[model samples]
Target: MSKNNKEREVTAGPVKGEFISPQELNDIEERTDALPPQEDFWKPPVRFGSVPVEKEPLGWDRRRGFRKLFPVVSLPTQVVERVSFGHPELEPNRLFWGDNLHVMRQLPSESIDLIYIDPPFFSGRQYNVIFGDQNELRSFSDIWEGGMPGYLIWLNARLYEMKRLLKKTGSIYVHCDWHASHYIKVEMDKIFGYGNFINEIVWCYETAGKSKKTFSRKHDVILLYSKTDDFYLDVSKSPMPRKRNKHMRVGVDENGREYEEKTDAKTRKVYRWYFDEGRLPFDYWTDIQFINWEAKERIGYPTQKPEPLVERIIKVSSNDEDVVADFFCGGGTSLAVAQKLKRKWIGCDQSRVAVALTADRISRLIEEEIGKIFSVPDFTVEHWGIYEADRLSKMPLDQFRAFILRAFGAVPDDSQTGIHGMKGAIPIYVGEPNQRSQVTAKEVEAFANAIRKTIRYQQDNLRDGIMLAWAFRPDAVQAAERLRDMEITDLNFVRLEQIRIDHPRFREHVAALSTDHADYANFLTFVQPPKVEVGWKRLATRSYIQADINKRTY
Candidate 1:
């Protein structure tokens, strides 16, 4: 059933109406107190069924894998940074990354308004892991070890998580092909309930590959389920189907016969239209097409879905400001369209490659004419925070060190060799969990003596007692021993942990580097049909002959 919604009520059939003598009616009404009340009789009967539940056969996990939750740190709010290329000028609401599982875990519960994920069908590992990397190719061997039952288990866990995260009013669309569509439908029905099952959409597409021996595969199944009865479906935004009458006239003829007829309001011309004309598309859809080489929006990604396709989904299922999420965000197409439509979105993908490409596409779109008109909140051009490193990297080493001492609350000293391997020139020691951000003890010892001497000299000469002197480090306990009774501002260190970077952060850096290695790189690509080459034909024929001989012998 839809989340948090109750089933419709049913009442018992009414008794036959009859007139009786007044005395008899009063006696009957009084005597009828012995009978069960009408409300009690109308209650729903208990459900009865004898259906066996399927159980999975176990014995798969011989070893457990490693799992850790480590926090990632980001620069502070006041730090302003900028980069060229790959970083999108505009921010999208949805992100599609490599691993849907990882992304889904990060999402907040009941945040999304709608979700439509077309995960792989369990159509054999060879077909499912079409991506041609060693990892994906080997995934077939690894996944098949457990078989379809195991596959069901894997999908069930994901579905459970999805159910938990969905809002009460949200909806989900699970896309699949013939291979496992039926099984998935059953599973979905069980999880979301038979009552919540919205539609079984049959999406048909054209296929040029003729199969004389069997039926041509030309359609996919989409199982739509709502979290609750209440959900947004924007009807006005959908395109009107051709061959529909523009207007209808309801009137009665001179014969006193009522009829409803299609008409053009202005011309009053009688129009013939199909019963289904101008109606919202039902479960079976035949208009959408698969991506091809000539498609204008194709960006050379293997699984890049079309813009119009996603755009239609955005318009129909969501409204402006509503959240849209995609866990397996590949090219960020959903997010891009969602942004255009003014919906907030969250997209996740594991592959660094996919994230980078998507970020680049979004950035380029913003640079064009559209970005200026629409601006997403939290992402603004006016206030890119300032990071201390960007400004310090330009200064000379000595001058930089001097500036760091005075600027970051560190004592000025010549004995100090700066901290190493920091992105910024001024190395701010990020403290451990629950500890304040501070400079290390090594630096304090090296610089405090010289910094104190410099301050003492300046203070004695200027008669202004170390006004510019400061110390920035995590452990102020030791610094107190060295600087003793002196004015020292201990700038607390930042906790490096707990910060998370957006998709654009690392992507921008990676994109700036040359990608000449990608061509030679072993990219994971999905393999389509016509896999047979010249050498393979001979091998197949030999195998066929051997199989025939074996069959004959048996």
Candidate 2:
């Protein structure tokens, strides 16, 4: 087992005050007691066994090695609204449109029962890859490259988040190619531990044509790991057939009923013969075929694995109503399977093309024609905050405030007078050059007074307070702090920002458009889904206004 690293490093926004002197810094540091070597910060600890990685040279060894050791760190206690879909009549299936690292960090630890990820394999060639629109391609290469070390770094960061998100009884299946499977296996061992190592399933499929000299490779590795010794594994559904003929029967004559199997070699006792019973499958599997162009589940995407493969995994690792997640959901294969099998699921991908296509595919799969007594869910597609706020805000004022507090990891302050930025998950407000006073302390105090009244009104009426506010701000932190402290006892506040609006120009454009169409008010409130045809123009060149303020990277 690898030793847990105990280095204490602050990796978040700086505190308000700074060290006045070297001695002051040293004194402050000395006075601070080391936090108990924190274990599993996100959720309950999951115990996983490990296994030795197979020795193989990956295409990007150096990059993978770096990633295996130092993964991307996550923002502490930040929250983003979760995106979900599927009809209420059906199970809860979600689709997240952001980075999985952030999403997993927000999720409660040990929550998901099963996870199946088909992460991008670090292959050298990628031309017209599936889900490769301009935006998606940029994100893909940004995450997948820098060679083996880079890929490992990316994978390890995600894995740490997964470790916290998984249930103690949960299991994870990591799918990969020959290019980086070995390195990934090593990383998994370090993260999940060698004791939880389960199976190395070989998904073998046939490829046409013969190799001239070397053997043609046509299989992928599925490394399975469990959270603990006692995990949920439904082996009965997909057990292998027993190879009766392969096992030699003792005490059996050449061809007669007098022959019986030997009970024990030393005892040589005759036992009733039992053969042809199905045996459980081992690590290597070769039955499932890859998706072909003519296959029913084909969705015009390269590297889309068959539904059967995912189905088998979902069935074996989880039960009905159990939540499952797939961060690298390509064509919604996992989502489709999860919906059909009655499991709650969340699938994420960077591509808008993929997201739209996945939504369409899932809808189609659910509506497959059966008979007159067909069933369909009241399906609803949602983006990020607005959709969730629409649903959650329906609760009473106190309840809604609680929801916001829990989600954002910050108490709402009614005093701040501006709409928070929805897409960026930051606190900001709309403003003009002249309306800067809207973010002042006086405004915050006034807003706080209004919230106190609203809380009282809600208490009297037994209803939730639902309202919207927007302002322009020059400083967000000071404004946010003022709001945080301006509260009547037990009555917090929530600030929501418009989703799709970017700059003041976009805000002006939206206001102009909204004035013309009152009925489309709801559409403008939430973040807009990606527009495929949008183009960009370069900004005018200018001299350096200020040096980059980012901390220097070592």
Best by TM-score: 2
lDDT of each candidate versus the true structure: 0.44, 0.50
Residue-by-residue lDDT tens digits, candidate 1, 333-409: 87677767878776655443444445555555554534567665322111101112323334354544444332223
lDDT of 2 by residue, 95-172 (tens): 654346544545656778999999878786643334443323323444343667666766776775676567889999
Off by over 4 Å in 2: 1-91, 127-139, 241-278, 369-429, 432-554
Error of 2 at 246 (Å): 7.4
C-alpha RMSD of each candidate structure in angstroms: 23.1, 16.4
Candidate 1's displacement at residue 506, Å, is 19
Best candidate, lDDT = 2
